[model samples]
Target chain A: MSLLRLALANLFASWLTSVVNVLLLALGTASIAILLLANAQLSSALSRNAAGIDLVIGAKGSPLQLVLAGVYHADVPPGNISSAEIERWQGHPRIASAIPLSLGDSFRGFRVIGTVPAFASLYDAQIADGRIWRRPFEAVIGSRMAAVTGLAVGDSFAGVHGLSDDGERHEESRYQIVGVFESTNTVLDGLIVTSTESVWLMHSRHAAESAPHQDGVASHDHEAVQHDHEAKAHAHEAKQQERDQGQLHNSVIRHGDDITLLLIEFSSPIAALTLPREINAETNLQAASPPYEITRLLQIVGVGLNWLNAFAGSLVIGAALSIFAALYASLRARRHDLAVMRCLGATRGELFNLLFVEGLLLTIAGIGVGLAFAHGGIELLSVWWGKGQAISVSGWIWAESEYVLVFGLLLAGAVAAMLPAWQAYSADVARTLSAP
Target chain B: MTAEKNRVLQVEDLEFHYDQPLINIAKFDVARHECVGLIGPSGCGKTTFIHLIAGLLQPIRGHIQINGVDLSQLSERETDRLRGRYMGVVFQRLHLIPSVSVIDNLLLAQRFSRTKVDRSYAVNLLEELGIAALKEKKPSQLSQGQAQRVAIARSLAHRPALVVADEPTSALDDGNAADAMRLMRTLTAHADAGLVIVTHDQRVRREVDRVVNLGDVA
Candidate 1:
């Protein structure tokens, strides 16, 4: 009925070539879209989780690992620092708030963080059920942890000694589940929180039980011959008393001193410039800036993503070339048909527009299919990775760059069809119409 | 005087050249409902003469007036528009877009001519041509005779004042050629339009009312 309809009909008549062009373009567009969505989500998740906390102070080791362990909880902590050292910096004039974290235990793959109530407030997490931990052995679980482990109020579970589930279990220290925190859509949602005293209690009891035993002789009220045995027993008792005193000393040291890292915020911007330097210079602790370390991590990841984007871009160019080749070749075969149209009184411009419309229709359909593929890919990624890390991958996230990409693809299609359309417009109608 | 006013085409001092002169016609004219045949040997510019009259080629020197409007004075776009509205061409090769159905091909003619498509009129025309049942069939599916009939139906779909057939029956057998010529002449007369058949087919030459030899004119 119309030129557009005629164009559509012709495309469908050559459905195989059209489908191949659309699929190639769709695949390229989907890959670029997936990359953009994933990169944006990764950057935002990193920034959101690292909010409020400006610096992390831990044992001198890999600064990146320290940030990863202390802030993101994605890796093992560098090492432990003494609580006395943390307390010494806690009251500094430049410090706004400092919360000490004691790590090294887990419940069902989720890290059990030993910190105070302020840690929960750092993530804006509230008690969704019951209450926060009120005692040394009571635990408050994160929303994700609670849902995954099915641990509710008044439930009790034993903690494993390390970050992984296969670590040694402390059967003696059973922690009662006191509360569950609401989902913060951050790393906080995958944590089991308790007081630092609880971690100290569990490890100290294990240490005391594993201590070396002193040899002893049994004494009886016999005679002077049993005096040697009595002397050995008295000696053993003295050794035992010394061992108990040493154990008490060790318990006191462990209970008051050990913590994994310090999550710190500055009262003023001046502290950011001075505190990390001062702490690293004056003390054995290593000061790591979360923002600097996270930026470095993303820069490293961005290189690989850039390569993938370039690959997808090349694929788009290839698809455009294919479209051009197909249309140009088809034009050669349809010369007589074009001539017939001319004889029917179609102008050169109308013939050119028909090809242009055909190319545009293919590109638009391909883009639509490609967008659907991108959203489906993101949804799959959310299910596979987001749940474990408490990252939300839901919602439509359209980027301005994608609009630019759509325009570029449409332009590419137009350019591809330009030559063939021109040929169709300038076809020698008289010669073609007279051909046998 | 009324008959002179009904003249569909008039040509005077028409001369066209491509490398050399292909056509030099002193005078030609066709009145309404008139049927004329243009006969020529092979390579004698029979098709070239048709192209010149159809506004597809500009004459080196000529005045071609269709319905008394001089084509040489019109712009290229206006000439195309005039041709779309006032002229129909049936090519030697019977060119129908192989992708579309017969009815759509006819509709396409109206579309290109910027005229309102009357489906019932197309159906009536096809039925009169005895190929109404093949309206939905693609050109490739139709027989050669059916394809040629479809081409004729498309050309006349907009009811042009003049229908030009360039070797319309050259590919047919003797019997089929005579039938095609008869059908084209009858259809053009029924539509109240003049017909011009440029061909070397003797059977077609006998079917028209008048014959002009291109070799003699050149």
Candidate 2:
């Protein structure tokens, strides 16, 4: 038997204490590893979803909510902005491109976004089957959406009124799945894309059916009144009828002649410098920078994560302390045993190494168990969050700071072992052997 | 070297004191393959003398030469190496590492000495001691007599030039004590190594070729 084997055997002799040390250290390691994986995934997901998009302009509300909803598809949109306002922003010479998103509907909890093809191109999404939506009722499903809903090309499903599966279904408007986009590893993967007119037409038909009297007046007035005074009276009545129609549409659709938000890219750096301030200051719409808002969100989350990390750090310290106590106690109880070893042929350094090897072995076992726990937790989370998309968090891609953590734990273990090892090294062999 | 050429152990004016004199010897020597018994009453420093000769304790003013090397002239590490290579010790307490099996305890000597482990030789030594079947057993599982025999086997596993056994049979009955002494003497004689046994039991004196009574030396 080698020194390491002897050390291992001795550790197993007091298996309960070793197990306690292993468990505490494993828990600490698992927490740290999980924290790193989650932080990395969150940062990557945020950056990927927010890339190439400079500003999100939506109805006045929380800027964070706007980015979370419009950019990440994770929350309800703050409110909707008018299509006229979106077109006005699109026409600005300083704007490179503006993509208007018409939301407020979902199928199986996956959002149905009404947008032009530019929205798909923004995320580098390509249709993997059939073709893009070319008509009001035709829809293109993202790869994740198709996999989750089991809706392939040529399948048809009705949209739900709100951005959740339990919302009221619009049974009158059946949208046929015309295509499915390939996986883009972005928020776009969880969307159903249709034309803006589809949302408007579906809600407009509901409005017309619920308020037939309003439509009757506009149609009937056009058939009468030939004289100038009569024509003026008819025109006035029509204007009032049109105003009534606008109110009915707004009440039914929630956003009158409007899209949910505008995704804006600046043609010049000057637009980034000037636009958000001007828009938030001058218009009813709120303009938000995606990168800034996401950073603020992460900073808020980092506070709690820091506290969790502190708790894990304390556990690691406790593990090391436990190792020290166990070794010291064992060394005290095994004084004669060590003296015997010395008598047999072991030097002081060899005895010291025996104890050191035990500590190192415990730490290594704890790390292995902790890594397994972390990876298993991440795998479960990935399966839940990404569903059928299989977002994997598997790798040894540790951050530089994580390397410091690993080395620091090893150092702590070594330092913990060193004290008892020194005692073993300098033990009075003759006195110990002579003792009863 | 010339003076120590035929002696496995030699001592000259050995003295050890801890606030007072615990041991004092004017001269002592053991020739190769000789069995020497050290006899003393309690508190007479028989164990102390053994420790001094084994280099576990440094003498205040003396020379302890084992296998032609002076123990006082060597560093702690050098002395440990020399002891591991040339001297084997059996403590009175039979201090076997309780966590390991008997065979592993035997192998531990080879491991610490950085010598090649020979399982066949260890097995043969255990068979000679009549504890071969108990090699796989832990020290805690063995009887008092059996554990003492295992400790003896471990000490001699490296086949040292000198074997120092301290009260190896103190806990045994008369019959068991005689058997242990005979086994120790036979094994050391067969290996052609000198043996130093420190004991107060008068029954052990008959088994040794010479007796050094610490009462006379101190």
Candidate 3:
């Protein structure tokens, strides 16, 4: 008989066991694939966000934490840094533009950051509807936040006290949604952006209620409302006048010198070198170069994660070895079959081919099944993740390296079958035929 | 036997062993169209001697020539070629390839022999062996006698020069064994192949041209 036919017969002789082995290998491969894919995407997002800014000036804390929380939206900021201290660095020749950030709130597990109009513009954030926030308490929702929370323009939602799902609620300081930002495949997908004044207003309201301080403050009742309305009207007129005059300084700073983090951009690369260190040593604040901090963090975490991947890879190798052992053990049971072929004048090389064909069949079946499983799983994850982001990937996410991995696995199978093939080759034809 | 005509198999000083040596036949030969019946008690080397002659085992002190080629000095590939070209085998237990259809079992001889298969001949042999309807059936689906007949058909399909039957009737009833032996001897003589059957059963011994008791030779 042809060696291929013989191999097929042997593989199917224990059909259930062969199927189970393929399934096991596929599961292990798919698990590693999903983990690696997620890690690659997350790392890419972090580096992409870090690419836009030169330095992050914030309250002195872990620079890595600040970069992660501020740029990538992965974690919380280290601590609140005073905007008053940040404002001093704004007009310096070394600093081109100093954008402020105010954090410490969330809407349904998504962080709410209060930033200037420049924040949206710098990030190229487009609005699906309505305009930017022009007053305190007005907010803009991210595409992912809106999709998940179902919050639209003119809807009001209260900010929770923490980043987690079970954080306390600040129901008293509910924010108004004035705009919805279009989908951008960045951290904005899971963030809430508004004016810095809105965050300061929320915190100030809490402070005023607790302390009941009135000295040097505007009237708290009807007169305060009336005066604030007049101030807003005057500010609007001043903006129109500045537009006509061709000088853009009429924009009002409602909460001056108060921000949690500052995203800075310098006019030149040389400014980045001296400006960050100067800011760190000259002021009580700390400045972090996002790219550097991110790379360092990646190096540290990447080393640990890569080590884990290697360990997982070795486990997969162990699975392959077990498969080899199982196939080899089956050779003894198949000796009689081999003998029949031998007496028919089947060559030793053909006998070896029979075993190799069996191994190839197992490897291909395992990879095929595993790929299907991984595709289905990745689709499910995409549905869940797309509810919070705009990134999409294909079902058959075959990379150049993945094919190499599969080839390597198939080669290992061949190597595993070699021993049994050699045994079959060296088997005594007469002895087996003579063996009852 | 004639000096050089129709001689299919020859052996000289053929020596074989198990854990301990026993029968040591000095000379053995079979010509084409001849039927040789080998009779011996249990553990008397009937099976071992057939195995050595089939090139399945190497005799320590002699040579085996099948179709005029020395099997002892041949490489594995050469021996396999020699076996496929000149010899067919039917064992006591009927070693039919279990996973394949009966026809495939017959075709296996052709495939490994690397020869053009005669499907009609295989079918005709199966019909003569009383398993014509079982061509597509697996060995597991066959009765013991039916399986044994199929094994014989497989051996003769390639039209080899020598056919070795190692206890082909061991598991059969008296009538079935007699029928099997008569059918095999008639098929071998018709194909002009030398038939060498190893069996201890005296009931089927009378059908062959000659019967040699291995115990008498030893």
Candidate 4:
């Protein structure tokens, strides 16, 4: 056996100790790798979903909640704002675009949003099938939501009264699927898009049906007039009337009627400075900057990620020390063999390399197993997190940061080996060999 | 080549110091193809003297040469290289690498000594030692006598010019010890190397060409 092979063999001779050291290292490396992958995905999803829409204007509550509700559609909005108030910001000189969203009902836990077609274009959304909604009560669902719900063009589904599937179904107000969006990998992928008028119509029908009947669910059953030829005819009639009533519905926005929020863009950097302040101060609505709120949210979450990084870093350090202890103890047991090697004409450097290479082998094996385990961990999380989710997590992404982690971990391993190697290097060969 | 024709080992006016002067030899020499025995009572600095001869310890005042190369003139690093290339030391413990197979043990000696790793020659040495079939066995798997044979095979792997053994047959029964002494004599003669053996046993005296008492040297 060459000295390298001797190092490898020595480790194998104490195979149980070697395996324990390797497992500790793998566990540490895996944790670091997982942190790197997960953090990158979280950052990408946060920034990508918040692109283009500079500010979110909604009811005054948590500015974070306003951004989460209006930008992400992941939380309840504070409340709705009056349409006259929405019209106040619509044609303002500082405003580039003010897309209104009316949120109330959901289908199968996917939000059925009331918005203009500009909302889809805001995400650079492309149609994957059929066409965009042209009238009230016709919906174009996000591709991911479409796949999950199994909704196709011409299929009709009624809105649920709340955000969750367990909510009361608004059976009187059925919206037909007109189109499906391409998977944008953005927040838009989890939503169903219909015009603001469809939201008003769904609420109006629900109100009309619920007013007279004590059992609101019995008054408009979910199992009626769905996909029948008569239902199609009735849908066709409703579409024609809604096309005529589009302008009339604009005037129907009274002092009592309200829409959810406005996602506003800036005409200039000057408008970004003025508009959010003007809306928040002069008007009774909150305007939260999407970039500002997202950064704040990430900073809050960054603290937790930092803790996890520290925990993983400590684990790596612990693994390094464990390896050091194993090598050190093995050196004590092999001192006689080492003295014999010296007598056999192995130089101090050769003996040093023997123990050093053992640590080196353990480090390489641990790093290799750790990286693989980390990537596998990310894959499991991706599966548990579900595909095409808002977070867009993946295990296969190879970041430069992971390479940096490997380099750092390798350095830690080298340091762990240095003590035993130094011991081997400076051992008094004659004295050791002469000992009984 | 000239050094090989002269003597394999030489020592004159040697003094080795530890906390005290443990070794002080006035004159010693091993001619080409000779077997020499070092017999002394326990605690007579026999191991210390051998270690100094091997360049594992430096003499405070002495001239020691292996194959006519001066140990004092060379750096400790070069001395180590010299020792590996020209000599094989068989310790009392027979320190073969415990996890490696017997054949690999010989290869390691050649590798550390910077000699050409000759597997066929290693196998031949094991054959001469009569442990050829045990070539693939680990040191842990070898019997005590078989382990001694493997150690002898490893020391003679590159056919060094000088061979040193420390109490090689002390732990063996008389039958195994006699067998070991016969093999040592046969192998040293086959390689034409000078041999030095340290022992406290009187039974070891008849196997060598000359005897040196460490008490008389001191």
Candidate 5:
């Protein structure tokens, strides 16, 4: 048998030892893989969601926190900017659209985002299932919220108090789920979307409870008119009057002049470049170009990842050292075997060959098994998490970095085995042979 | 005969020690094509002498030359090369490699040795040693006699100038030991190599050209 085959056979003979060695390597590599994969996806998602928007005008705060809260809808908006103040910028010469955001509530940790239809357009969001919100108090749900809440078209539900369950209640204003949006694979998927007026009205209900449940009555009347065609003629004029009363109260309380953030799109590159500095100086508000801010965020995260990767690499080196020890320890036990081979005219190099081959074979086998296990684990995680969402979780395991990790782990194993191979080469054949 | 052609091993003023003081030897030599038996009781330095001859242990004060190359003057690399190319060994325990098959054990001999092997000759040697059928078996699978035959076959696989079989028949039964001795002698004779078999077994003492007893040496 060839030295490699012989070494492999030896490794196979001690199945438990080899498995433990391989498993350690696999665990170390896989943990590193998951950390890297998750970070890359986070970075990718950030860049993808921030693609169309040129700049964000938000209340002065941490720029990264603002991006997380404003564009992603993943966190609470930093603070409110007067909607009236935002409206002044809506029709500016350089402005394309000013999407105002109103946020104060959540459904099961998912933020309920109150915004105009420009919110959808800004992220290239489409309604793959039903339609976008057209009326106040009628909500269009994001893909993840739709899947998690199991809310279909026309299903009505009330939002929980605040982002958490313990916040003060808004019992006066209940919402009807008008549509379920398709998966966008963006942070928008983790939200409930409604018009800015509806969000204000919900808060208004909290402020003035006894003020003639105006919008609630209008929506109830609208639903009733849908069932009976004969009542349609009678209800049409009544519905209009109710709608007018609802709007009059909402406008009086409509803090739409105060917005948490403004996602700005520009028709020209020059306008986009000059707008941030102009807005930053013009008012107390801050403007951030998302791509630049995101790049900076990634740089901070990248340093952490490099240190983590080095840690993982060092653990792998430790595993290699363990393999070296296992082989070295096995050498004395194999002395009789060596001596016999020497008597048969086996040279020192051949003895070394046997040991080296054994080390390499053990490493290769462990790496192969570990990589396969890691790949399968990643695939399983993706499939489980991908249910009812546009976000593909399977991309993590198949990424370029995963391939590099596998190659790197195998290389480390080879280098580990070389030390003991040299020791076996210079072994004292006569003494070892005669040892009892 | 040419000066290089007749000499297999030459030793002069060989001395060695363990925890004790040194035992000096004035001169000793073995010619090519000779089978010499080193007979001595326990702790009498026969194995130590063979170790020196095999280039495994160096003498405190002497030189050992195998074929024409003086091992004392050789570097570790050259010593290793000489050992690989010119010497073969059979331990008292017949230290057969346990992991490989008997055939692979034979093949391993060529890995370090300078001598080119003939597989057919190896097969013939195994056949002569009555281990041809057991060539694919591991050392652990063979009987003591069979394993020793494999060891002898391995030593002769490279056709080295000297074969030092230390206490070669020590572990075998009387019948098996006799068989081992006869087989080793026949094989080394056919290979035309010098054979130094170190053992205290007086039963097989008559088969060698000369019996040097370490008990009577000093």
Candidate 6:
């Protein structure tokens, strides 16, 4: 016989309306919750993967492609830049460090990257066992790569000839897994790291075998082989329009001494302003700032995100209206009940509490179910997504803005119920009782 | 003056109006344990008169008293408390919450009276009314006579000082009306509560101890 008990009974008495309102509110809340969590985690991972490197120096092409491929290993590298030219930039006063990424091959679906031991420092990477590659053809597998490929330390595997999974296998020089990089939750977790020499040796021998029967004879001098290899690689690339990108890529695996891109760090903030401009303008290679390209990418992507956010916001507004309509119609129908309660000695304030509490229950049930559904869905997606390998987005991270969303919607529910509650509060008992 | 001391409800120079005056009374009183019937034709403001006595409507002039407290002297909040604690009303159409059971309707009145919920007394009332088996049944499920009996139970559940019933027998056939009149009188007498029956039905005359004609307002 408590007012709350009475209110609860009233709410459940109209179970169909109550259920529909809860679902509408839940849909809106879940939509916004998913968007907020996805955006926050995606932005975090993107920024984390692109940490440290100020600029990416590569063959002249799209800066975004260079940044994506170079920093994230997510796309195709435009082509290659000469190591001698990169070495010259390494000596520049503004350039603090230069890490060369010599890309060309893959084992299973993961890329096998040829980089110096110092490349590990960019991510603060640690080797979990054994050691970094000491000799040519030795490799350190990333933790995720190790888990996926099931490659153990001291194991060897021959790589395919392209950046992708389906490529011509190169059996002449197999890479031995010398160590495993500890999980860093970055793009590095999906790559296999080795000395630049291993890539050079593999491609030169593969190219020698492609032109006839020159596979058995080994070349000892990197400088000599690179000089001869680039001449033929460029000649094949010039006619690349005749064939597809993947075939042309496999055909041009000529020199590992010529790297795909140079990851550059500036000595100071002034170097960031001056160095990329100098590198892009003064040389054949293009130097793209990772942060700049990432910002531009997000700006283009943000338009879509904003539209989706607006769509979700409209759902929230629609839900508020739904709850209002349900409550208003219910109170109008229950006017007699309101008058009866008044006649039974219930005060105006008590009547208001009764209706307001009804609104509050609907709002809370909707928000609670919506948040639970949103977070639960993301947790499941994370499992499936971790294996798919783009960037790691966790459901465990909660955005501060979701708290605001919940509070704001609760206030909206209160506003929606306000007029009807007031009508009930001001109901005339004598007139209501006499009405037929 | 001695009768005034025993009065459960007293009205003096009560005047209320909407455009033209709807209710005008010089004086009326229902002493303790009395059963008074106020008889009038339709639209004679019988319902309005009972509302004024129940403190649901404030008189434009003069005042009404319930349990010897001047209703006009009490705050609106206090008036509501007074109505819950000292006054009981049964309308032509019952106001039992259709969502809850018949027994729950009685408990609702008891709860609003700010009294401890007495479930045993509510069961006893239903028992006295011969609807104890229907205590858990919703109002919508009951027959009209059963529903009326539930309404009577609601009004007197809190043992109020005065009970006002509006057209309680108007909707019933003669047999049901007789049974309803008999129940209201006996129940109020058992609680030592004064009763006011407002009706257009002349058939209620023999059941009442006194009769007041509302058609004599002029």
- State TM-scores per candidate: 0.87, 0.88, 0.77, 0.88, 0.69, 0.86
Give me candidate 4's TM-score against the actual structure. Answer: 0.88
The number of the candidate with the highest DockQ is 2
Decreasing DockQ order of the candidates: 2, 4, 6, 1, 3, 5
Between prediction 5 and prediction 6, which has the larger lDDT? 6
RMSD of each: 8.3, 6.9, 6.0, 5.3, 7.9, 6.7
Candidate 4 vs candidate 6, TM-score winner: 4
Q: Please, what are the lDDT tens digits per residue for candidate 3 over residues A1-436?
A: 5667766777777888788778766766776666566566666666556556888888787888778767777667766666565556687787878888877777777888878787877668899988777766678888888888888999998886557656656688788888999977677767888766566565555444434344323221112121122333334444433443442221345433346688888877799779877878987778888888877877888888787678757756765776687678877887888887777788888888888788778877776776677667877878766676534444556544567667777787678777887888888766665555
lDDT of each: 0.82, 0.81, 0.75, 0.83, 0.71, 0.83
**Per-residue C-alpha lDDT of model 5 across residues A205-312, encoded as one tens digit per residue:** 443342244422211101211111122223333443475355322222232234467888786789866888898888888887888877887788789888987887
Worst 10 contiguous positions by lDDT, candidate 3 chain A: A219-228
DockQ for candidate 5: 0.30
lDDT of 2 by residue, A1-436 (tens): 8888899899999999889889888898888888877788668778888888999999888999899888988877777667787668878998998888877778877888887778898889888999887666678998888877788999999888666566768788788898999988888888888877666555554444434444422211111211112222333334444543432222122223557789999999899889999999998889999999989988998999999989888888888888899889999988888987887778999999998888888888887787778877777766676555423354444555567767888898899999999999989998887777
DockQ, all models: 0.65, 0.75, 0.56, 0.72, 0.30, 0.68
- Docking class of predicted structure 1: medium
TM-score of chain A of each: 0.83, 0.82, 0.76, 0.84, 0.74, 0.86
- Candidate 2: which stretches are off by over 4 Å? A84-95, A213-257, A267-271, A282-284, A381-402, B1-3
Instruction: Put down candidate 6 lDDT per residue, A67-163, tens digits, no spaces.
Output: 9989988877877777676568778899898888888788886888887877888888999988887666778988888887678898999998566
Model 5 residue A244 CA deviation (Å) reads: 22
